[model samples]
Target: MNYTLHQLHVFFKISQTQSITRAAEELHLTQPAVSIQLKNFQDQFEIPLTEVISRRIYLTDFGWEIARAAEKILTETHAINNRILAHKGLLYGRLTVSVVSTGKYVMPYFLSGFMRQHEGLELVMDVTNRQKVIASLAKNEVDFALVSILPQQLNVQQLDLMPNKLYLVGRRLDDSSLLSDDPGQLEKLPLIYRENGSGTRSIMETFITDHQLVVRKRLELTSNEAVKQALLAGLGYSVMPLIGIKNELLTNELQIIPIKGLPLQTSWMLIWHKDKQFSPVAQAYLSYLRANKEMIVQASFDWYQQF
Candidate 1:
């Protein structure tokens, strides 16, 4: 009954990670420290909160219920802190955003200025696949979701930020004439791919199907990083976001293969459920984005537009 807020915080992290060691690493605490706090918290309750089976932690039904309550309590705590700050004409609160894996390259540009303006705010950016981003938005688990391909399944409002261009790229070829102009030539090179549910993968598949290109699917990777590595190793070519390969392109590590009607286009968007009630922090973020999105795009990605 005498559980401290700190105990709840520790337990919440443990529940999310499902590993005391990982929780400790993220919290910047020692393993023993996290274990001690968890034990202390569990001592206050008669029912077991976490049970270890085969050295793996599992939250019991009671533990799941407590975890849900802890999340609400933590949210309210953030609200209270922001409320106090607002009284003094200052901004303070937590902002959580979920973005597709490739959006890691883009969301920071949108967030940098807002973060500088509100130094007191706590922000969590979760980079995941498109499916998870959609799920988070549908479940109202996050304040915003950043994606290239719009999720039609969710009734959401969105702010279009910038154009996302996907280009067919491979390792720089020493001989320009080695690659042919024939449309059927691409079929000879293996095609690297992102996973099935990825926005980029969807776009790539659509392009291939529309063109009736018979490609050798060499590898299927779950992330952009892996696909890029595969490209660098001369394993295969992939249609990747130009933003991600800017440095590689500039350094001549990767070269775009100009296919007819190439560089598939989509706009990057910041989306939220239509009925989402924004927290004060979320409101501040949206306001900043609306006011400065154009400026941020121009400043941070001027080269992108030029290219």
Candidate 2:
């Protein structure tokens, strides 16, 4: 009862990040200040909330419970604030979103308009691989997730946004003989691959399997930028999202390899957990996306084509 919302907020950040340093950085507070607030909050509880083990912070059982309650309290508080703002015919609230790495290329375009319209809104975005993005959504750590491949394990509500096309690209070599539609030739070329758990990697894997094709993987990269660099360096051919490689393709820095059954097509989707209670801000964004989906997609495609 003695604890304040400020204290709860600090504790919640620490619980989420599991590191005082990171929590402090995100909270924009000095490390010592965060430590003092945490200590004071623990005094109010009169129970051990967290402990340092092997130089890493781990939450105690009580800490976990408190963190969960803190999340609910914060969410409800934000909902109430949003409702008040709605009554005033104003929009002002924070929106957190997570997207897979490939989505990074297109998500900014999708968000720019909405963000411009709501100058008072705060937007936090996490760009990670598909696995981490899905995990964040599962934990309710983010309000929405943008991805091409939806997890089969989670119950979620999704809106299809735009077409996501992936192509096989490599440095344009003078050897025209290397360019062929024969699937067997793929095994002879050095292939650049994405790290495991990448949605693009998964799709590529399936495509390879279905076609009974083979590839000589020369490198395993974790990010699109790295892969693009490797491709530019002629390290190997790679399956990459067109959005990520549009500029390269336009400039002829990267050439799409014509292969049998290639240019795999998928749809970008916006997803949220089925059990989540939407705040007014979340609802507003969702409605905005629904209304402008076609325009957004067209604008993105047009932008890419110009590159």
Candidate 3:
């Protein structure tokens, strides 16, 4: 069966996004236009390709098989284009990176600079939580991930980007003000924990368990921003990344409660699949990260400390 590259691109995109509307948004096509293209591809085949239930789209078994083939074809096409661009002495390609939300504060700045430096490259940045970032990397859905927490799977190359320290923060006048710099004080403060499965939550759990301290409060939240807001509102004390609340610290909306014996170290990492081949643009982006690693870490420390 003969199908145009555009139809294959639509098929791949829809399969990747799992929703025609999202695929349309990504490809800058109207919903009807995307549906029509998908219909054309389905018409070329012997079996049904797509179905909708509860307004959600799903590919049939045959459709998935075709989508996988289309993926291989697209990958080869990209490789050929990269080879031609290399021959022309031009570095041109696409790189999609997934990152944890906390890293969103500084990671995008570096990525923006890299894109500016490599003018011909196209970049897509997906900022989500740490767990989502890991899933993206594991699925080979993104070129790389910037994460503060290590993944459960150990197959990816995780280069240390910077040290992320956890701080116990609270409203300036909250009951947690009674918390002294002593680590034992952690047992007395009402604790606001990150949502389960978070890298930060994992670290906190390990620290508390190792110390044999019973957590005084167990309110759980997901985002760093949510944790900070809860603390600022005097709901309870929270262990949060220093970068997440720099502005709050600067404004004195919240203050760090010095807690001793807490594990203060988790490194932000640039993670990618060990077996995945890097295009020239991807290599240059990684090189840019390593080249500025120390400077970036130091500046982040300085900026957070100013609060």
Models 1 onward score TM values of 0.81, 0.74, 0.71
- Give candidate 2 misplaced runs (Cα > 4 Å): 1-87, 303-307
lDDT of 2 by residue, 1-307 (tens): 6888899999999999999999999999999999999999999877899999999999999999999999999889878877776788888988999999888887887798999988768899989888999999999999999999889999999999888888788998677787688766677788888999898899988988888876788999999889999999989888888888877887899998888787798989999999999987799999999999889878667765542
Best by TM-score: 1
- Error of model 3, residue 34, in angstroms: 14
Give one digit per residue, the lDDT tens place, for model 1 in 21-59: 999988889999999999999999999999999999999
Which runs of model 1 end up more than 4 angstroms from their true locations?
1-8, 25-53, 57-80, 174-178
> What tens-digit string does per-residue lDDT give for candidate 3 at 149-256?
767675888788766778778876445556567676777778998877777788877888877878776588878778877887788887777777777878888877
lDDT, residue 137, candidate 3 = 86
Best-performing candidate as measured by lDDT: 1
RMSD (CA, Å), each prediction? 3.9, 5.4, 5.2
Error at 146, model 2, angstroms: 0.6
> Distance (Å) between predicted and true CA of 170, model 2?
1.0
| Ranking of models by TM-score | 1, 2, 3
List where candidate 3 sits over 4 angstroms from the true fold: 1-88, 174-177, 298-301, 305-307
Error of 3 at 143 (Å): 2.1
Question: Cα miss at 40, model 2 (Å)?
Answer: 24
